[model samples]
Target: MEIKEKITLDMLTKDSVSVLRQKFITLNGEDVQVGGNVRNDFTNCEDDRKILKEQLSEDYYNAVMAVWEV
Candidate 1:
């Protein structure tokens, strides 16, 4: 499924962790095999930061940062 809108790290404060996690997966096209896995858990701020910093592509990162800056 396609995401209706852009997502960002700021979503952590504005939306539920579950919602943000789903958006992250959608935006990044990640295959979530396990529901409760660490890679998909946005509740863990450290993990979220790591994914943003190390895993996500440049396009996705820039898109997220654009939303964050606004």
Candidate 2:
């Protein structure tokens, strides 16, 4: 799914320690399976960052165009 939104770190870290521990398990690929909550959160964060960056670049271009037009 495409994420066209922004999310704060606090929103992602609501579970704090539990989320970190779960992420560690999945990162280590330890036979201990971590649920989709952590995975989806990471995915959404990454996708949202990409979308935000694109939006920022477009805004920058528009601002530069306005300056050049002036």
Candidate 3:
């Protein structure tokens, strides 16, 4: 999957943690595994972020996004 979307809180709501986790890792350039650390990685990514936004509900998405933020 290609990336370059500068991930936003709203950009993460679809893919499973496993998928997102992989993305988080690739974008981060490390295996820190910390949500906050990985989350920042997505900011420089693209395609995947677009795909992730249409999967989860707003509430569920917010909860998931919150994990990466904090």
Candidate 4:
């Protein structure tokens, strides 16, 4: 059984940053790994990971919010 979930900008907008961070870990941790190494420690690039997550969250939030701009 395969259950696929799509995370959209609207979804991110509804969750707190902490929630989003957890979601990012569950869903995107592998995708964000350097060189796709499953054994790599995320802490090795903690600052980079934080920046990437923040950028993604902010980007999604802005995109969704833009829809309501008058």
Q: lDDT for model 4, please.
A: 0.34
Winner of 2 and 4 under lDDT: 4
List the candidates' TM-scores in order: 0.33, 0.20, 0.30, 0.25
Model 4, 1-70: lDDT tens digits are 2233334332222222222222222334353212221221222134634643565567554553354333
For each candidate, the alpha-carbon lDDT, in order, equals 0.43, 0.33, 0.41, 0.34
What's the residue-level lDDT of 42 in candidate 1? Answer: 44
Report how far off residue 42 is in candidate 3 (Å). 11
The ten-residue window of minimal lDDT in model 1 covers 15-24
TM-score: the better of candidates 1 and 4: 1
Cand. 4 TM to true fold: 0.25
The segments of candidate 3 whose C-alpha lies over 4 angstroms from its true place after superposition are 1-47
C-alpha RMSD by candidate, in order = 9.2, 14.6, 12.4, 12.0
Model 1 bad stretches (over 4 Å): 1-47
Give the per-residue Cα lDDT of candidate 1 at 32: 39
- Over the stretch 1-70, how does candidate 3's per-residue lDDT look in tens digits? 2433223343543343432322233444743332432343233224534544575457644666565443
Instruction: Per model, state how many residue pairs clash.
Output: 0, 0, 6, 0
Model 4 misplaced regions, further than 4 Å: 1-6, 10-56
- Top candidate, metric TM-score: 1
Output the TM-score of candidate 2. 0.20
lDDT per residue for candidate 1 within 12-31, as digits (tens), equals 33222322323223435664
lDDT of 3 at 2: 43
